[model samples]
Target: MGDCVIEPEQDYKGRVGDDPPPYIKMPQNIWPKDAPFLREGLYNYYSHVFPLAMKLVRIFALAFGLEEAALDGIFKFPITGMRALHYPPMPKEECGTIGLGAHTDFSWLTMVLQDSVPALEILNKHGQWVQAAPKPNSFVCNVGQYLERQTNGRFVATVHRVRNQTGERRYSLPFFLTPDPDANIHALDSFIAAGERPQYEPFNVGDLYIRRVLPARHRHPTSVKYRDVPESEWKYELLYG
Candidate 1:
């Protein structure tokens, strides 16, 4: 492996944004960098990643007791987002502090390609942090909030955080597969028993993105409209950072 390089953010001036951009982002590839056109690699990964994600969704659908093609409509016009991230080495002084905060992804699913420099961790049922180190070229996949809502919480979405204690720079690529903008997400009728009740109110794909997700400090601009429905009434809804 090549020795990792750590560059001071000041050298890049406005190029790196005010707060190092919360980890290197592939935000529609709009962010600037030394190699601005370095998007070919991302596209290369997406070519394979998207199809794999779709295939996995069908498999999950069957496992969750729904027909294999149950998710076909949602996948027909899905918005699959991909990102390539780079987290520079943290100083020894702030090693314990958070590099990336904890939050649950609202997408249907997320797959990560992590490098040797470790940082990712997930919050387990016991509320303890668990390290998720990389292994060769294998990708780490996580269940997301949408999948949980659709399953009536059958498969809970994981809450994960990142910290870069390694003296070397850390890199990872995460691809998120989300439903079509206008499609609605709800627990399937087939999963409910005669006396069982549905845990959540049906919501459109846009509600989770616009209302809950967009209010973050480093905003992700989107055209999706927000719903006034308070997250409290929806027991299944989870807030975002």
Candidate 2:
């Protein structure tokens, strides 16, 4: 996994100024141009991890009597990508917010592999944060916006955060899986028919991607308004508001 750190020629320091830190792309054909790490990661995820995730998703779908493929079309091309993250040791004074801020992923699914460290936490419905401990050879999975939309309020996209509380350096690999750029994301009819009404309005995955790629302050105004709301809240508001 360390071999994946293909640094880009230009440092990302000056590019974004002081928002979220800059991300450095791999230097070599670490992700071959033709393959575009996005595609490569998707391939690897589908081959190695999708079965497990899909099994869980399928069970949830069956509870609603929805076909397995009800969610398949949404994952076509599955914009999956790997993020190699390194959190430096924190100073005693700034120990409170050492890792990442509280936020949820923007994709359909996220599979994380932690290396001998525990830094992730999930926010429950009551808004309390709970630490997510590392399990041996097991990956941490979280639902994302696309799936939350497709499930029509059946499944959820939960809130999560990361913090290096032990005053130690940390490294992690998060594999993000998303819908194809051109795919349309909306509540599935079967889900709606079996469950409650669709919670979110129909939206194109490409449009969401564009908004996500831009700076948070620069994202579409409507999207910014509900950035901190739970997926359930945003799903309804985005659909009707």
- Which regions of candidate 2 deviate over 4 angstroms? 1-47, 50-64, 193-197, 216-241
| Model 1, C-alpha of 23: deviation from truth (Å) | 31
Each prediction's whole-model lDDT (CA):
0.67, 0.62
**Per-residue alpha-carbon lDDT of model 2 for 28-115, expressed as tens digits?**
2244477577655544644565456556656656765777656665543335456768888887776657377777788777888888
What is the Cα root-mean-square deviation between model 2 and the actual structure? Answer: 11.4
Q: What is the lDDT of residue 225 in candidate 1?
A: 28
Q: Cα miss at 220, model 2 (Å)? A: 17
RMSDs, each prediction? Answer: 11.2, 11.4
